[model samples]
Target: MFPSKDAPLKIGAFCSIAGQVRFMCSGQHPTDSATSFPIYSRLLKQPEPVANGGKPAGITVGNDVWIGNGAMILPGVEIGDGAVVGAGAVVTKNVPPYAVVGGSPARLIRYRFSEDVILQLLAIQWWRWDDEKIKREAAALTGPIETFIERHSVAGTATK
Candidate 1:
């Protein structure tokens, strides 16, 4: 969360970020530069040279995202809704919605649900549900995805 007006870290509702998860997008040394050092920038008292061609960018973690402990989200990375970042993963790129990514330079491990179900869940958008409604649909919400989607989507209740 370095200070940069143009690079604002935005985390959406209901995200489960673990301890030491870093959302960094600014104050980085430029890899493209002759040296990955900011001594000149510091000596000159100027803006520190940054990655992404000196154009620092923001990071976005969407709703229901679960970022594990020690995961490092790099500059300009957009982690989509319902995605999971495994422990110690160094995410360097955009993660798709519902993607389960892990490892250095995070790779796609798997998706949380089938494509159709994911679309349905996205359409359901249960995170936006009111507290009372969520409490009322607790059983369905915590149950199997099929039952949850059936009761919520077809019956118009909610999804977990």
Candidate 2:
């Protein structure tokens, strides 16, 4: 529910947040010691001590990210730019840029493209472009990798 002031939740532009995705943002009950009832609720009841250091680190989702329906993003996960979180995925860690992840504790299934292409895309940073430019370059953005690269290539670029 709450995003930390220090690292507020950063959901980048053009990102698609699907329906029923849960962002767990606040204090979690202590698992080390067994409790009959939730301690966090008790803390909420009492404000004198102001217990449980408010909201942990915020989740950061980068530009062009696609979070699928019913995905549960736990606190402190950093989903990188252009990443795709599959439906019902429970993200528990940092997802690398352009990665496609899925499963209960989401694992990287694959990357959308080769490292070189990813690098090129990162460099292009199409998400940062102005609306007019983005519209003008829609074909390049949606085109094949080689075509896109050819359209916007820096001379002497080499791929591994």
Candidate 3:
């Protein structure tokens, strides 16, 4: 459960979170044989190492993203801005900006925007818009997503 503003915070942003989001360091696991063993407890206790080294990495979720319910986002994974992770997805890798990924060991289904457009949207950082403004546009915000994107997407955009 989320805490009240007055309480000491453990979980940040319980409400729909947006903008360059990243999970805590505790979520990743190691894939290499040196660090990996058949033992369950040791594996559970040790955070997985990144491919490059032993240092821990965080899961990063970018702006305007929707991570579906019950998705287990692993450590060191980065979910790019505007991407959507389907419900119950178990993410294991870095997702590109504007991608839509799902399934076990989540894979990229498609990019949500063209390269230029994605870059523009990233710069816009619309998720940082004030809460009131977002509420005012709620209908449009949740409307036919493609249409909404068409109207609000950064300049020089095409459909996904």
Q: Report every candidate's CA lDDT.
A: 0.83, 0.79, 0.60
- The C-alpha TM-scores of every prediction are 0.83, 0.81, 0.58
By TM-score, the best candidate is 1
Per-residue alpha-carbon lDDT of candidate 3 for residues 41-154, written as tens digits (9 for 90 to 100): 254454333443443345556666687776766655666777888776777787787798888978888887667666666655667788897898788766775566566766
Q: Is candidate 1 or candidate 2 better by TM-score?
A: 1
- Candidate 3: TM-score? 0.58
Q: Candidate 1 on 16-97: residue-level lDDT in tens?
A: 9999988887656777867767664477766554533464578889999999999999877999999999999999899999
Query: Which residue window of length 10 is worst by lDDT in model 1?
Result: 151-160
On TM-score, who's better, 2 or 3? 2
Q: Measured by TM-score, how close is model 2 to the native structure? A: 0.81
Ranking by lDDT: 1, 2, 3
Which residue pairs show collisions in model 1? none
